[model samples]
Target: MSIQLIHAMNDLTATHKDLLELSKRKTEALTNNKLDEFQALLLEEQKLIRQLEKQEQKRQEAAEAWKDEQHHPAETLTITEILGRLDVEEQKMAEDAAVALTDTIRELKRQEHLNKALLEESMKFVQLSMELVNPSIQSMNYGTASSDKMSGRSLFDSKA
Candidate 1:
């Protein structure tokens, strides 16, 4: 059971590393404004995320099974708690797997944050471009109070 738990943790770590790589590529795609590449990365990311979720579920189940076998009284058990019941060799493996997974997930979060900021900036740029291309007449008006009263009139009077 401990072995199963360790295996699940290792699998999760591997998947997380792959996701981190994808995140790096996505950041590059966003930076370069490669819409097609970005879209492809998004699809790949989704697939990985689904796989990660399944791995997480399996890890949880393994942990639960270990807890049951060990006769742990707690309704829920953490990896650290489970580690206490493991032998020295298994403890080391689980610890290493957990640490690696944690580090990779942290890095992935940082990369995702950067990507989000880039996307927001891109959206702002597109909005600015659209406004420039089709600015409202009200926005074009920069007149004093008296001129403001002639709101509906054309800027240039043909009869003048």
Candidate 2:
């Protein structure tokens, strides 16, 4: 049982490593503003995310089975908690998996933060371009102006 749990953790560790690599690629794509490449990478990321969800389900099942056999409750348990109940060798394997998973998650988060900043910067640049192109339009207001003299024409009209 402990061996099975160890195997599951090792599988999770590998998949998380792959996810970290994918996140790095996503950050690169976003920073470069490669829309085609970014879309392809997003699809790939979604697929891997589904795989990770399945692996999580498997890990949960294994954890529950181990808990039941040991007369432990069915409550949610972290990998470290489960490792505490295992033998010496299995505990070592689980510990290694935990460490690898933690490192991969940390790196992934860093990449995601960078990507978010890049995306926000791009959006701000686009908004600035829009403002420059249409200086008359305060914004895309859809009516409800404070005056009755103001025209009801669309705010996006370039000729107005």
Candidate 3:
């Protein structure tokens, strides 16, 4: 395996694990009324997701290049016929690659969407489970607020 490919795969897996941890953090933060931390972790996860996507793109590019090389025109021919025949085969191969890339891009995009949804659903389950366990830790309002003046603001608001 390519060093870059290996690193990319490792990074992607690490990022996914980080995202899972962030989801857990969000659940805890919401339970403890620390919405700020929850939002911060969510943002970090989003950033990591974007990075992971970029790495995926790079991997795809490398794979496409390898496929292109594999379909190169057959070696050896009459010196005169070589250039013309090579051009034809190269064009055919390129067209084939274009079609393959389009299909693969669509499929990968769909998979990415599904992965996002799965993570979101998992987070929802976490939040719901926390609710079930404590039953009073709070919903989305965090810990609740006093009725005093300048109160009832978002949980993210400064306490001091």
Candidate 4:
């Protein structure tokens, strides 16, 4: 294998480590309600994943060429032939990564939808309770505004 191939593999390994670390940090940010930080970390992780994929492609191509030469000892493969194999491997990796990323992003979106619905439902329950105890809130104008405001009507209303 060429020195370049070794370098590519090493680069991919480093990128993978960075991605894993970023993933952990993102999870921590999520737990701490640091959504902005979590999103930033996610973007950085994705970029690193792409870099890793690119390097892996180069390594795989070089390895395949080395294998082909070993398999056909009577003939030497042209540089172009080796590069062709590498290109094919790189393209395949790109497609696979795209599909994986798409699926993951879709799942995250679905989970976000569910979470939003749950939050809305919880707010509804709280609003219902306030209305039950203070029947005056059911009417727009019954008790003093401050009384309804303090009782949590304004709280849920502001949310809406």
All models, RMSD in angstroms:
4.2, 8.2, 16.2, 14.0
Ranking by lDDT: 1, 2, 4, 3
lDDT (10s digit) by residue, model 3, range 1-160? 1233334445555555555556656666655667688679778878977987887787655544433554535343222332233356554544454445445445545545655675577789989998888776444344435334347576585866
lDDT of each: 0.91, 0.80, 0.56, 0.59
Q: Per-residue alpha-carbon lDDT of model 2 for 36-147, expressed as tens digits?
A: 9988988998998899899888877887788888888747777767777888887887888778777888887887888788889989999899888886544545455544
C-alpha positional error of residue 137 in candidate 4 after TM-score superposition, expressed in Å: 18
Steric overlap count per candidate: 0, 0, 0, 0
Q: Is candidate 1 or candidate 3 better by lDDT?
A: 1
State TM-scores per candidate. Answer: 0.88, 0.79, 0.40, 0.43
Model 2 has a clash total of 0
Alpha carbon lDDT at 117, candidate 1: 95
Off by over 4 Å in 1: 142-146, 149-160
Give candidate 2's whole-model lDDT. 0.80
Which parts of model 2 are misplaced by more than 4 Å? 138-160
- Top-lDDT candidate index: 1
Indicate whether candidate 1 or candidate 4 has the larger lDDT. Answer: 1
